[model samples]
Target: MEEEDEQEEMYEVQEILVDPKQKAVRIDKFVTDKLPRVSRNRVQNGIRSGSILVDGQPVKPNHKLSPGELISIVIPRHGDRPDGIVPQDIPLDIRYEDEAILIVHKPPGMVVHPGVGNPDGTLVNALAHYLSDTDIPVLPGNDNDRVGLVHRIDKDTSGLLVIAKTESAMSFLARQFFDHSIDRTYQAIVWGAPEPPDGTIERNIGRHPRFRQKYTVFDEDEGKVAITHYRTLSDMYYVSLCELKLETGRTHQIRVHMGSLGHPVFSDEKYGGDRIVKGTVYSKFKTFVERCFALCPRQALHAKSIGFIHPVSREYVHFDSELPEDMQSCLDRWHHYVDHRRANNQLEP
Candidate 1:
């Protein structure tokens, strides 16, 4: 959810007219180059779905733009179809709620909002259903897809999220997040112990040029600034549990930063933690790692805690969450493995 491109929380309608002297280009490429977060694939999908049109008519993705032609598009808040966010019966772990806001403990694997591959069963859909009688007018500037959401975590990262139920609440909470005053802490099982136990990582992060789905560190001139402060909670030899605090939120900031430090989050297939990055090559060790991966098929990361100012009450509020079963069970196995190896004097020097 910290990905730069994934920051938008409102459905948007954009209209652009080609200049009289503009050169002809494929609509997909033209739209992609013109928009900030829009991808070529998303543009093509929009064209196919008839959400994108030129000169008041639907066109192919490869349709060439002509001078004075008008281009119009509707970008979904996340990936939901502009018209597809319907109230559903999806369950939510509501932690706290009031007239001004709602605090939710989002579980792993549940998307915060609907998108292309995901049409429903999202937190937004559930909120729509839960607040059906509240008459909450869609958080001011945002469309119904966003509802009360001010920020979000990844679909695979379980954690706390604050939702603003009113215009004043949304403005207040959004400002806090933009100012980096909303404190958030995450626990991640990462490969190897970090050098010096704890420190801060300052780098720029941006989407990979070749792999659009992945993010990588970039130079100051290219990407946005990202900072993560981390401390090792437990060193299990082969892997360590780390607590990370973010100063600036960029897309995949923690994943990219930790991977750059040579200790990717454990079992994070996208960042190369799915393989054995450290520890012995013994068959037993390999088997143990494979089992651990089975215990937690996704990245071993959790949004452990969050603290922020309450918009209406003007008081500081903090929320904490326990690790989910998959992550906890995986850690338990690692703990047992480490203890047994140490007792048997089998650990490498």
Candidate 2:
């Protein structure tokens, strides 16, 4: 315990070593070169404080030390840790691949990019490995398009996502998604059924009035135009299964639209329900959901099917990811319960 604490409380002090020809250089630059891992902000902060001493006295952030001056740097222990975003060799479930496009299955809980509190094991990192190993182009416009990443899905959302390998393909696919020509259908377990079994939500979505963290539907100028179409698949006592086809893909569009209608998705901590289930497949499902939720994760809302006009050939291209295991188990268990209850009642009568 003492060793661990000492290791965490690490600090350093460096003697000012200056070259005869390096006397004209700036202090911040000198510090930056000396400490390549430290950020510019930290160097500036250190200089402004008395922690950085020049010739055994405090100096401003801008002071350039002369050669032969004894500059003392009292490196403070970690005030903040750097977030390391190194690319790791992670496996990606690729559904379809070609020179023009690639369809991948993004697993649940893998964040699309490095963000606050999460700095590793992202979809971006996975794509990095895919590029190095396969030598495929992911870039759409520039050299970074070597991965030709066309669009992105949420960290938790899984299914058929298309990537463009070339600039032409990228522009074409971007336009397709923007114009809502691509057929994108998702299977969602929402809290309740819509009053009308099949309908469209034309409400605009913007930041919520009360909770800025979430999106809401209301008449506002700052909001973006959004639309969604949903059809009831199955109706339960407290919840329902529905197929959502996107007319316009906006941030949290499906989840927010359903929430605006008072029907958020199941196990959706952001919009609403985290209903606990106790059973067999559902027990495994409960564990799956709990694990997914262990890190602000929600139940996977899968893109069951996607159809689009081929960017290069003009012919249609379609792909699908079967309901992921956990969700499939939920549906199977729901049906099993219905069948068992119906047969038991019939036998009793």
Candidate 3:
């Protein structure tokens, strides 16, 4: 029942020692409580598959654990889970590649992996086609076709991604992400300039109670701790360009955190960035802002860079990407607008 990395091996083993003061408990329940994000059904399935063992002997789900005993569990990882997915020959913007790993520049409008609504035409499908002849390991606990992905970015956010070609590479890269050793930076254009210009936004993020698809910040201990360090790069009066560094990779952390500060990313429809949140209500200014929106219909955000230790080389690797055309065009317009207004003011004097 625990959610594990999809790129992990088929057989993962864990050993635990029971305490003398502990009472007898069902093996399934014991495991479910022990593993974070694991479910009861998964533990039962593992037991049924004879993957659960006590003292080197397979046990049933109803079996109870005793004190002062050794418990070992062999989780059967999901095998060839992407068999149902058909690979398509989609082109990729590869940045760096070697025997063990490859860094790809993912374009906007491409889904990272297959899911309920998106079953095909994903980045995974393209990777499958690109590596059709290679032997990529099937990761445990992953139900979908995310072959070698260690992490993911939003569909609308274009960025660089590192993919593992071997199991050792996968494990090493995943560990780096879990330890927060990977350095990731993003560039975004927001509605208005933040008051302090540069600061850290530390808040807890959880699923919205009413909207299942959206996320929100929590004041209590309900959500996971999320931290983002941001600094202003350009201040254009109405809107500002900022760089953000993440300490944790929670879902929608950057978007939700910035939205809570009343400076949502430009054109982010999910967090109400489509509407004008700053600037005058005059028809001329509104129209100008509309033109800026038209230049970049999606959120004005991009994964600019990422750095991590090379899994096989034991050396540090860093990759950076330029802003996409849409975002660059949007910023150019903002700069032009600011310069034009300054010229008008000088002429009036």
Candidate 4:
């Protein structure tokens, strides 16, 4: 699910008012002093970006701040910060937590970390706040924004993610992912039933040439090797529910592979699943499909389960989550349509 997607710039403007009894000080110094994590260089960078404004006008980094003046600091919500991650009070659906690890259910449309268009309001920001009071050490070699994170899913792919609370734990869990020793299963609603009910897709995946934000399958000599094993759980003919397991975790591996097999994951706009791929061309069918799209506005894929070896206990641990409401609602609609068609002896050929 972690694919290179287009990003839109977003800014978080923070306004500060000079204290009544404050002395005239350089703006950069004032900013670094006023903000907890803001550094002098970051303030200067913000000034250069015209993000630091005094009285609604951009000022030089050495501009003197006077009492009662309103200073606005506009910082990109993304990972452009030089200081560290910003902690926000965002709620998290924590599934499991211990000394060495944490598991959480990420909802659809929530970015895993701060980047590009999503600089703030991410799962990492939430983790920053959640662990603010704890003594959990940040992962070695990782940015503070991605402190405990070892893996990431797409913004729209709802699922469970494992987080490492300590450096040793981080290395331990990361090794499992690198070795493909981690067990992961995803449930996706894809267009049409695959030819072989159960099969494996082995292909090389790389970023598209023209569309840098998107990915495409490539020759063996080209991109990275990716493997996905899928089995049909239910076949409604026009669309089927599938369970996919990964042998290698590549960006957009499941989506790209399913798309290569002519079974794009339902509602995956980037992979052509947002249209009527397998259903009839009738107006009624179109309406039904459109309704389903509205129900699940994002890709109909869920990371159902994950299994890994505990870093502390060395015991195997597994976690599972139910399908989110949007996906479940979309599937229910498809089930109802299929049942109605079967009852009328008009099921699609």
Candidate 5:
């Protein structure tokens, strides 16, 4: 017989000082803007629970704070919070780790963290389990939330990711991402070739009509500004490999904008791409890929590199991950198809 195990984590709030230059800012909005990763719901929850204060008095979420006003915030440890971020030994390809930061290469199809349909096996869960034995100092009044989380990549995308080990680092890193100061490069397989080798695709992105699961560039509703720059790396057969640099990190920005340009991600069934390779253009190559390399399951997208200023050391650093097994295999087959077509002069422009 084995005894059951259980543990509890404590949370507390910390003091915050308002800057005179940031006066007239909405308190909740200010916090959300300052802590981009902290969800607005958590911020509101902290306010209602009296875990947050302005000038030592509990304030409503709608209240505005003056610059130079002292702020008292209580941030709870994540384990005790509903967000339930815990560390686990889920095996990570860590490129770098320090007392103030942790960076990993998240594989494709692995969710970043738990969300509505997903509640576990997240990067958040693994992080929590990894730090289960470690001590986390919480602020007195702040609610228990993700402590070191800075930003996120989608479940189906794989690449370099950064995690903050301290609250100070979290805030700084979040600002860098929000202000577009961070350099993130992504590799994608798109359809067709644009006129120039390198070009820009700037458009407003919003939800798609009739297709709620997808996004589009032309919309009747309000949308955020989006921009993507790409350079054609190779053009062979009907597909082209492109490198994308983002100017804005909107939901599905890369996929949607690429689709708008007539090139949805390969294997992307959501954004008008047929997962089946039955089209006349890919008939022969499809049979070859499906037989030789069946490893590539999802879209052939990857985060190739990320560079930023280290929040703790203040030193600039860059990190990169090679294409994972699946994408690598896909590229292998792609190379084969390109050679086959070129050898026979069957390739199209």
Candidate 6:
């Protein structure tokens, strides 16, 4: 039998100092309150495994905090964390490349990094292979598997992506993303035209309680704030093409926000855009819609453009990509459908 490759485990250490005015709180509660996404149970497990320390000594979950004490926690890198990423001979659409940065036009169905289920053949793997001859430094204090990524789009959403070739460049671009200075615009075909045509969507987004794989809008106190500004570009009656600008980037922010507005991206299966949301019940219309879906098998969303300050040159740079063939063909089909209907006076007033 062939020897199986064991998944590599990585650990990250975080340290915190006890405040002078801090009360005697349990270590588990203190760590949970400090870490936003971490749960108390996980912290307790780490404590049980001797992964948590106080002033260089292992501590229990119920250990009481004292003023002027140092606390340290060793966290396992898992859950969307990349293991050992093997270099693969995957093709990449290089839009722009320089010594410190590279802009890639990511195609639909390409994962940005390695994660559960998708362990290979990702953009990162391809980048690793392409950069094997060069000295692409691993990001400091990050998973080595993701050496170049500053930001990412969804797997099935095609568009422009900027990659950092150096640690300084990565830090500079990551800061831009944190400050919301990086300009990113996406083009999407949605099921219905948004009311008023142009507007901003401000909602909190978090993982759904029932559907672990899906995200949903939540109360302000429950989830992180997400904002998206959008305007309709073309109205095809049942569907509308729109341009969306993200003010804040959250997981599934665009998809969840648009779904909340009743205009999910066309053919987004996870968010209920696969079924006809705005069309007649007739069998012919259903068949036509199915054909349109077949034309663009994935969600009709594309990262059309991105702009940011160059980390090394300190000059502003922008890049744009034409719509992928799949999405373009789908839009052309819709345009032809609309035009033919209008010519025959079949469109509703």
Q: Put the candidates in lDDT order, highest first.
A: 4, 1, 6, 3, 5, 2
Residue 24 C-alpha lDDT in model 5: 84
Q: Which pairs of residues have clashing backbones in candidate 1?
A: 2-250, 2-251, 3-251, 4-251, 79-115, 80-114, 80-115
Superposed Cα deviation of residue 200, candidate 5 (Å): 0.6
> Relative to the true structure, how large is the alpha-carbon lDDT of every model?
0.80, 0.63, 0.77, 0.81, 0.67, 0.79
Q: Per-residue lDDT tens digits of candidate 2, residues 310-338?
A: 86787898888787776666666555654
lDDT of 4 by residue, 25-48 (tens): 999898888775655665676675
User: Model 5: which ten-residue window has the lowest total lDDT?
Assistant: 1-10
- TM-scores for all candidates: the values are 0.77, 0.64, 0.77, 0.76, 0.73, 0.76
Question: Which is the leading candidate under lDDT?
Answer: 4
Native-to-model Cα distance after best TM-score fit, residue 188 in candidate 4, in Å: 0.3
Model 1 clash number: 7
Candidate 2 wrong stretches, greater than 4 Å? 1-86, 135-146, 220-222, 276-297, 342-349
Better of 1 and 6 by TM-score: 1
Error of 2 at 302 (Å): 1.2
Clashes of 5: 26
Question: What does candidate 5's lDDT look like per residue over 32-87, in tens digits?
Answer: 77666566766775665455678867688888888778876654435345534545
Local accuracy of candidate 1 as per-residue lDDT tens digits, 104-124? 888888998877798788898
Q: Residues 158-260, candidate 3: write the lDDT tens digits.
A: 8888887755566556656655788989999998889799999999987899999888899867887888899999988778999999887777888888999
TM-score between model 6 and native: 0.76
